[model samples]
Target: MIDWARLQGVYGPAHDVPTLLQAAGNGAKEAWDELWIQLWHQGNTCDAGIAALPALASLAQHTNRAVRFPAIELAGEIVGAGLREGRPLEKMKELHQPVAMLSALADGWLSERPAGYRVCFRAKLALDGFPVLSDVLDDFLDFCCDVSCPQCSDKVSIVIGDFGCYSSIRDWNLGDVHPIPLRPAAPDDLQDAAQGLHHAAIRDEQPRLAWGLRHVFGDAECGTCDTAFSVLSALEAKRSPSTEFQENAGAATAPAGHDEGKNRHWPAPPF
Candidate 1:
C-alpha cells in the first residue's frame, strides 16, 4: 500500500493522487486532466508520478481502450523523465517490474494497432531507456522544430514532413533563406536505436514514420555556415545533455547506392 500523503508531487502533497487515479480509471476526463497537470506538467514528472507507476500499469493492462492508451502514454512519459534528468530507470529498482509489464503490454498492442505508431513508438523508446530520442520524436507528427546552430548560433528550422525532409534558416520576410536538403540514412546505414525504431515502424506498416526516421538519423549541413553535421547529432545536442545518441548515426556516409525512391505512399491508418 502506498502512503500517498507522504510523497510529494508538483503540488505540495500527493494525497489526492490516488483519488484522481481512481477517477481516471473510471473514465473521468477531468481527473485525467488534473492528474496530468499535477503529476506531469510540461513533461516534468514528480515523485508521485514514479510512485503511481504500478497503479498506472494496472490500469493500462486491464482498462478499456479509452483509458489504457493514455495510461500507458502517461506511464511512459513519467519513465522517460527519469532518464531526461540523468536518472536512468535501471537505477530505480522499484520500477523495474512495472516497466517490464508496461513494455510487454506495449509490444502486444503494437502488433494490433499499426495506426497508433507514433504513440506506441514513443512508449517503446521510453521502455528501452532512451529518454532524449523519445522526447525528440514526440514532435514527429508536426515534423518541424528550430535548433540553434552550434557553429554560428543561427536558428535553423528543420522540416521533415510531406513537403520534404530538409533544414533551412527561415526569415519571416524572406522565407527559407538558405535551404539545405537532408541526406536520409539508407536502411543498412541506420544504427542502434535509430535502426530499431525504423525497423519497428516498417514492420508495423508505418512507412511514413519509417521514412522520417531515416532523415532523423541522417546528416545535414548548416544553412548559414555550410558546416556539415549529423542531423540526429545536432538534434540530440540541442534537446538534452546526452551525447549517447551521437553514435546512433551508423556509418558516417550513406552507402554508394542509396535510394529514397521507394519512400512514398503512406497507407497506414490515419490518426
Candidate 2:
C-alpha cells in the first residue's frame, strides 16, 4: 500500500489522485488536464507523478487513448526516460522494474495476467513513439520569471507558471525542493546537487528550472546563486555529461520562452 499523502503533486498534496484517475478512466476532460498538470507540470517532471506511475500504469487498458498513452509515456519516462538522459534506464534496471511493468502494459489487456514467472513480453513494447521530452537543454534556459525563482508553485493561471522555490519538477532538475530543509548526499554535495540542477536546466534547456535557479541566484542573502554558479563553473571546468547533452540535445519537455513553461496538456478524445 503506497502512502499517497507522503507524496507531493504539482499543485498540492496529491489530492484527488484516485478520483482523478477514476475520472480519467471514465474519460473526463478535466481529469486528463489536471493529470497532465500534476504529472508533467508544463512539460517538466513531477516526483508525485513518478511515484503514482505504478498505480497509473494499471490504466493502460483504458478506452481513452489520451489516458493510456500519457500514462504509458509518463510512467515509461520515469522508469528510465523523460529527461532521456536520466539514470533510470541504468538505475531502474539495476533495481529491476521496467520490464514487468512494460510487459503488463503491453499485454495485460489482451488476456489473463501473466503468471509471476511467465510475465514475458508476448510482444516487445516500443517506447520510441512516446518520446520523453525532458532531455532538451534550451527549454530550461530563458524565462520571464524575473519575479521569483519558484520557491512555491502557486498556480496563477490555468496551469502553473514559473515561480521558483515554490513548485516541483519530478524528473527535470538537480536541485529539488522536497523535504523542506533540503540537504545533499556527500562529497560535493551542495555543489554537485547545484551543478546537477543547473546543468539539467542549461543542458536540458528546462528554462523554467533555469530561471528558478536564477531566482535563487537573485537571493544574494541566501548565497545560493553564487554557489550554484560556482558549481556550474566547476562543471563547465570539467567536460562531462552536460557537454554530451548540449552537443546532441533532443526533444524539450517544455517550450522555450518566458512563462511559456513548455505547456503540454493532453487533449480530450474526439466524440
Candidate 3:
C-alpha cells in the first residue's frame, strides 16, 4: 500500500494524487492535466508517479478509451522515466507486472482504432521500455523533425507529409522551395525500430504513417553542403537514441499488406 503523504510529487507531498486520479477516472480532463503536471513535468517523473502505477492501471480498466488513455500513457511515461533515470533494477522489477498490464491495455486501445495512432505508438514504445524512442514518436506525429546537417551543421526540417517527404532549410516566407527529395527505403531494406513501425503502420492501415516511415528510415542529403546522410541517423544524433530498442524491435513480422497470391506495394502517400 502506498502512503501518499510520504511520497513526493513534483509539487510536494502527494496527498492529492488519489483525488486527482479519482477525478481523472471520472472523466475530468482538468484532473488529468493537473496529474500530468504533477507526475510528469518536462520528462521528469516522481515517486508519486511510480507509486500510482497500480491505481493508474485500475483507472484505465474501468473507463472508456478517451479517459483510459491518459491513465495508461502516464503509467508509460513514469516507467520510461524510471528506466531513463537509472532507477534501481529491483524497483523496476517490482513494476514489471503493472507495466506489462498497461502495455496490453495500449495494444487493446490500438485495436479499437483510436483517433490518434501516434499516441498509441508512443504509449507502446514507453511500455516496451524504450523511453527515447517513445518520445521521438512525437516527431513522426508532427510530420517533421528539425535536424542539423551532419556536414555543414545547417539547421533543416525533414518534412514527411502531404507536402512530400524531403529535406529543406527552414524558410518561413518561401517555404521548402529548395527541397531535396528524400529516397525512401524499400520495405525489404528496413530494419530495427523503423521496420517495426512500418509494419505496425501497414497492419493498422495508416498509409500516411507507413509512407512517412519509409522516408524516416530512408536517405537524405544536406541542402546546404550537398552531403548525404541517413534520416534516421540525423534524428538519432539529436538525442540519445536507444540501441537496444533498435536491435530488438526488428523481430516484427513481415509486411502484411500483401494480397493472397498477388503482388503488394507500399501504400501511396496521402499527398
Candidate 4:
C-alpha cells in the first residue's frame, strides 16, 4: 500500500514492488535478500526499503517466526539506522518516511489488528542490538561461544570493509579471545558441548542452552573462561549474543560481556 513513487534509493526507483510482495508472500529468500540489500545497504539508507515498508509490514501474517522475525527486523533496522544518522540533510530525508511509516503501522496493528504484527515488533527492535545488547547479552554470548565464521575475515577488497563478526568478537574479548583453535570446532561443535552439559546433575538447574555450554571448551569447562556454565543461567535460555550482535548491529561498542569483565581472557567469556 506504500506509494513506492515517494521513495528513492541509489537506484532510480523500486521497480519490483509487486514482484517483491508476491515473492515474500511465498517466503522467497531471494525476495528477502534483495529487499535487505536495497533498503538497508549493509546498514545504511533505504530508498527502496522505505517504499516497500507497507508490503513488508504485512508480513506479520507470516506463520514462520524464523522468516517473519528476520523480515520485521529489517524494518526495525531501517528505523534504528535513521535514528543513528540523525541530522544531515541527506540522511534525514532517507530515514524520515520509514520511521514515520513504522509508527503508523504500529498504531494500526496494535488497535484494530489480530494477535500477530505488533506481537514482537518492539521486542524484535530491542533484540536488533541497535544501540546496545546488554539485555540479550546471554544470547549473544551463547552465539559467539557456538559459531565460528572464518569467512567473516575474508573481506580484503577495497570497497568491502569486512570488520563485522570477527571484529566484534575481538572487541568483546579485548583481543584476548579467539575461537579455541579447534579444527572442526564450529557452531555444531559447541552444540555437542551443549548436549553434554545436559546431564541430570545440571539439567534442572540451568537453561537447556546453559547445560549444553557446560563443556564448551572441550571435555570440560575451560578453566581460563570466566563464563561459567552456571553464569549463563542468570539470564534467559537459548540466547545467542554473537548472533544477536549480528542481527541487531549498529553500534561498534561491545555489550557488557556476560562474564562481567572477570573473564578478560580470549573466547573464554563466551564459554
Taking all chains together, each candidate's TM-score versus the true structure is 0.70, 0.36, 0.65, 0.38
Better of 1 and 3 by TM-score: 1
List the global CA lDDT of all models. 0.72, 0.39, 0.71, 0.40
- Per-residue alpha-carbon lDDT of model 4 for 1-271, expressed as tens digits? 4566666754557666667667866788888777776676654655565455555656744676445555556766655454344423234464445445444444333333335432333423332222122232232233332222222322110000111122223333443233222111233454432333233113333343332233322321222332213223312233443344445333333333423354532334222
Q: Residue 89 of model 2: what lDDT?
A: 37
lDDT of 3: 0.71
| TM-score of candidate 3 relative to the true fold | 0.65
lDDT of 2 by residue, 196-242 (tens): 44443355433454443443322211122212122122222232332
Q: What are the per-residue Cα lDDT tens digits for candidate 3 across 162-234?
A: 4446777756655554677789899999876556666777887777667766887788988888988988778
Q: Is candidate 2 or candidate 4 better by lDDT?
A: 4
Find the candidate with the highest TM-score and give its number: 1
Ranking by TM-score: 1, 3, 4, 2
Q: Model 3: how far is 162 from its true place, Å?
A: 2.6
- Give the 10-residue window scoring lowest on summed lDDT in candidate 2: 117-126
**Candidate 4: lDDT over CA atoms?**
0.40
The collision pairs in model 3 are: none
Error of 4 at 108 (Å): 18
Off by over 4 Å in 3: 1-4, 16-34, 41-44, 58-67, 77-91, 116-118, 128-142, 170-178, 189-194, 225-227, 239-271
